[model samples]
Target: MRLLVTGGCGFIGTNFIYLMQERHPDWKIVNLDKLTYAGNRKNLLAIENNADANYSFIHGDICDKTLVTNIIEEYQIEAVVNFAAESHVDRSINDPAPFLTTNIQGAQNLMECARQAGLEKFVHVSTDEVYGTLAKNEPAFTEDNPLIPNSPYSASKAGADLMARAYFETYNFPISITRCSNNYGPYQFPEKLIPLMYTKAVAGEQLPIYGDGSNIRDWIYVDDHCTGVELTLLKGQPGRAYNFGGAAEKTNLELVRELLSILGKDESSITFVKDRPGHDQRYAMDFTVAQNELGFSPSVTFAEGIRKTIQWYQDNELWLEEVKSGSYRDFMAEWYGER
Candidate 1:
C-alpha cells in the first residue's frame, strides 16, 4: 500500500511514519509536511538509512490543491492520513485567523483534492477537545458526542471533522476520522504542556502551571495513538469516526507532579499562573468503538509512557537545545518564504 501522510514530519505524524515503516516493510510511505514551526525534518532522521525500500518525503502544504492532487496522482497513493493543523489552543486564542485558514480551509482543500484523485481511504486525525469539557458528573466523550468546541483551535478542528463526515455521506468518499485524547511523547514541540514543563523543570527554571492546575485530560502515548490510527485506517468502516483513548485521566496538577518527579525536581520548581480563557475543565474519552472495531488498545500505560518520554528527552538533549535556540523557527521562515 502507498500512503500520503500530511504533517508526517511533526510529532505524532513522524512517530506514525516510523511505526508503519517498522511494521510493514512492503508499503511505500510519502510524508507531506508544510514544515511549519512545529514541524521538523530532524524528527525523521531515524529513517534516513532504513531497511525499508519504499519511503520518501515531500515538503508541501495541504492547502495547495494542485500540489496535493499532483502528488496523489504521481505517487498513485492508495490512502491519505491528514495530521496537518494549527493545534495549540493558546496560540489559537492569540490568532484565530491562521487556525481557520489551516484547520478548516486546509481540510476542505484536502478533501476536495482527494475526491478528485480517486483516493481509496482518507483518515482524518482529530482531538476529543471538539466535544468541549464534559460537564460535572457527565459521561466521557463517546463517538456520538456532540461537538461543542470551546476554543478556536477545537472549533476549527470540529469544523474540519464536520466536513470530513459531510464528504463521506454526500460524495461517498472513503473517509474515516479518529478523535483522540491528549498525546505526549518525543519530538513534540516544547510549546505544549508536557515538553514545556519538562524543559523548564529540567533547567531548574520555574514551571508554569496554568490556573489551579485542576483541568483534566486523557493522556495517551504518541506511539499508541499511531497504532490506533493505523488500525482505523485499515479496518475501520468508512464514514465513521472512532474515539481513541488511553483511559489515563489525570488533573493538570497531577501531571506536573509526575513531570517534576521524573525530572528529579523539587516542588519549588512549579509556579502557578493565570488561567487560560475558555479553558475546558475536563476531557475524557470512551474508546470502546476503536477497541471493539479496530482491535486497538494502548500498549503503554500513562506512567510507563511518561518514563519513556522523559528518557527520550534526556538522551536527545542536543535536540532539545537546538529547538530552544530558535533555529527551527528560522528554518521554517526561510523554507516557507521561498515557496
Candidate 2:
C-alpha cells in the first residue's frame, strides 16, 4: 500500500502522517515537500528514526513534472494524496504569482503524472474559500456549490478543482476532490489567525482583528479533517466532491474572544486593524454528503479543538519561536541535527 503524500511537512499534512502511521504501520508512505516557509522538517522528526520502515521523505517541488513522474514510477505509487498548495490568503494577497504557479501548474503536473500512472485514487485536498462568501441566511456550501473564489489563494485552488474534473471527464481517471473548512491544530504556522493570536497573546502583543472581526467561518480540527480525507479515498465514490465541515460557526471576533477566554487572557489584547481587500464576509459548509455517504463528520468540537491547539502552541514554544524568528532558515544544513 505504498502511496505518494505531498506536502507532508505542512500542518495538516504532518498530523495526517501521524494518523496514517498509527492506523497502517505496514503501509509505505512517501512524503514529498518543498520545505517552503511553512514546511518544517522538525515537524516530522518524531517519525525520522522509527524502525517501522513505513515512511520516507523527499525534498522536491510539485511543479517539476519530470521529477513527479519519475518518483511515481520509481516508487510504483498506487495512489496520490495531494496536500500541496500556497495556502495563506494574506500571502496570496501580497504575492499572487507564486500562488498561481505552484497551485495551478503544480496540480497539473501531478494530475498528468497520476493519469499516466493509472493511480487508483487521486485525492485533491482543497478549501471552502473557493465558494466565496455567503449571504445572510443562505444555505451553506454543499458539494454542488458553484466555484466563486475571490482571493488569489482560493482562485488557484478553484482552478485545480476544475482541472481535476477535466481529467476525470476527458480520460476517466479516478479523481476525488475534498473541500474542507478552515483547519486548526498543532504545528500550524503562526501566520494563521488562530496560531498567530496564540503566539501574540502569549508574548503580550495585540491580536489583529480584521474588518470588525465579523467574518464567519466553520473551523474543523486537523485530525477530524484527516479522517474525512482518509475515508473519502477508501469509501467515497470517484469523480465526486465532498465537503468536510465542523458545522461550528463563529465570527472572527467570537473565535478570538473564545481563544482569549481559553488562555485566561482578556479582550484588551485584541486591536482592530485594516481589513484585507476583498475579504470574504463569511463561509459555511453543509457536509451532508460527507456525513451520509462516507459516514464522516467532525469528531472534535471547535472549543475542544481550540483549547488543545492553544496548549500545543504553549508547549511547543521553542519550535514556534524558531519559525517566528526565521531560525528555520538554516534547515538545509541542520535538517537532521547536522551541526
Candidate 3:
C-alpha cells in the first residue's frame, strides 16, 4: 500500500508508523508533519537512518491545500491516516485557535484532497474526549454515543469527526473514524500523564495531582491502538466510527501511586494542584463494535504497559532530556534548513 500518514512525528503517530513499517515492510509511507513543538523528528531517527527503509518525510502542514494536493499526486498515495491535531486539552484551553485550525480545518483539507484523488481509504484518528465526561457509574461510551465535547481540544476533534462523516454522506468518500482511550507507551511527549509523572519523579520534582486526582481515564497501550487503527483503515465500513479501549480504568491518584511504587518514590512527593478548567471527570470506551467487526482487542494490560513505558523512558533518558530542554527545536531547524 502507498500510504500518507500525517502528524507522523507526534507520539501515537510515531508509534503507528513504526508498527506499519514492521508489519508491512513492502509498503511505501510518506509522512507529512509540521514539526510542531510536540512533533519531534528525532522520534523516527531509526527509520531515517535505515538505508533501505521505504519511508519519506515532508516538513509541512496539513492546512496547506496546495502542498497536500501536490503530495497526493506526486506520491500517488492510495490511502491516508491523519494523526495530526492539537491534542493537549490545557494547551487548547490556553488558545483554541490552533486547535480549530489544525484539528478541524486541517482535517477537512486532507479529506478534500484524498476525496479528489480517489484515495481508497482514509482514517481520521480521534479521541474519546469527544463524548464528554462520564459519571463514575455511567456506561462506557460506545461509538454511537452523542458527541458533547467539553473542551476546545475535544470540540475541534468532534468537528473533524463530523466533517469526515459529512464527506462520506455527501460524496461517498471512503473514510473511517477511530476514537481511542488514553494511550501510554514509548515516544509519548513528557507533557502527557505517564511520561510527565515519570520524568518529574525521576528528577525529584514534586508530582502535581489535579483536584485530588480522582478523575478517571481508561488507558491503552499505543501499539494496541495502532493495530486497531490499521484494522479500521483496512476493513472499516465507510461513514462508521469505531472505539478502542484497553479495558483498564484507573483514577489519577491510583495511577500516580502506581507510578510512585514502580519508581520507588514516596507518596509524599505528590502535591495537589488546582484542576484545569473543563477537566473531564472520567472517560471510558466501549469498543464492542471494533471487537466484533474488526477483531480488535488491546493486547497490553496497564500494569504491563506502564512498566514497559517507564523502562523505555529510563532507557531513553537522553531523548527525554533533549525534549525537556527544548534542544530538539534547534536540531529540527538545522535539519529542515539542510533539507
Candidate 4:
C-alpha cells in the first residue's frame, strides 16, 4: 500500500508507522506532520536513517491544500490514515481554537482534497471521548451512541467524525472511522497521564491526581490501536465507524496505585489536584463492530501493557530527557506550577 499518514511523528502515528515498516516492508509511506511542539521528529529516527527504508517524511501542515494535493499526486497515494490533531485535553481547555482549526478544519480539508484526488480509502482515527462520560453503571459506548462531547478536544473530533460520514454519504467517498479508547504505550508524549505519572514518579516528584481520582477509562495498548487501524484500512466498509476498545477499565486512582506498586512507591507519593473543567467521569467503549467485522480486538492486557510502557520510558532515558527539555519544560512548569 502506498499510504499518506498525517501526524506520523506523533505518538500513535509513530507506532503505526513502525508496525507498517516491520510487517509490510515493501509498502511506501509518506509521513506529513506540522512538527508542532508535540510532534517529535526523533520518534522515527531509525526509519529515516535506514538504508532500505521505504519511508518519506515531510514537515508540513494538513490544512495546506496545495501541499497535501502535491503529496497525493507525487506519492501516487492510495490510502490516507489521519492521526493528526491537537489531542491534549488540558491544552485544549487552555485554548480551544487550535483544536478546532486542526481537528475540524484540517480534517475537512484533507477529506476534500482526497475526494478530489480520487483516493481509494480514507481512514479517520478518532477517540471514544466523542461519546462523553458514562455513569458507573452505564453501558459502554457503541458506534450508534449519540455524540455528547463535553470538552473542546472531543467536540472537535466529533465534528470531524461527522464530516467524514457526510463526505461518504454525499460524495460516495470511501472513508472509515475508528473510535478508540485511551491508549498507553511507547513513544507517547510525557504530558499525558501514564507517561506524566511515570516521569514524575521516577523523579520523586508528586504524582498529581485530579478530582478524587475516580475518573475511569478503558486503556488500550498503542500497538493494539495500530493493529485495529490497519484492519480498518484494509477491511472496513466505507461510511462505517468502528469502536476499538481494550475492555480494560481502571479508575485514575486504581491506575496510579498500580503504577506506584510497579515503581516501589507508596500512596504518599501522590498529591490531589483540582480537576480540569468538564472532566468526564468515565469512558468505556464497546468495540463489537470492530471485533465482528474487522476481526480486531485488543491483545494486550492492562498489566502487561503498563509494564511494557513503563519499561519503555525507563529504557529510553535519553529520549525522555530530550523530549522533556525545551518547550516541554515551559509547559510542565505552567501546568503543574499552578497545582
Assess the local accuracy of residue 294 in candidate 4 as a C-alpha lDDT between 0 and 100: 90
On residues 226-281, what C-alpha lDDT tens digit does candidate 3 reach at each position?
99999998899999999999999999999999999999888988888778788999
- Measured with C-alpha atoms, the lDDT of residue 17 in candidate 4 is 98
Off by over 4 Å in 1: 327-339
Candidate 3 runs further than 4 Å off: 327-339
Best by TM-score, which number? 4
Ranking by lDDT: 4, 3, 2, 1
Model 3 TM-score relative to the real fold: 0.96
Ranking by TM-score: 4, 3, 2, 1
- Candidate 3 residue-wise lDDT at 6: 99
Model 2 residue 129 CA deviation in Å: 0.5
CA-lDDT, candidates in order? 0.88, 0.88, 0.93, 0.94
Answer with 1 or 3, whichever has the higher lDDT.
3
Of 1 and 4, the candidate ahead on lDDT is: 4
Estimate, for each residue in 1-339, the C-alpha lDDT of model 2 and write its tens digit: 888999999999999999999998877899999999989988988898886658889999999988899999988899889998888887787679999888988998999989888888889999999998997689999888899999999999999999989988998889999999999999998778898788788889878888799999989999999999899888877789999999898999999999988889999988887888898988999999999999997999997899899888888889887887774334422421231
TM agreement with the true structure for every prediction: 0.95, 0.95, 0.96, 0.99
| Backbone clash pairs in model 4 (N, Cα, C under 3 Å; residues 3+ apart or in different chains), count | 0
- Which TM-score value belongs to model 4? 0.99
TM-score (C-alpha, index-matched) for candidate 1: 0.95
Q: Could you tell me how far off, in angstroms, the CA of residue 132 lies in candidate 2 after the best superposition? A: 1.0
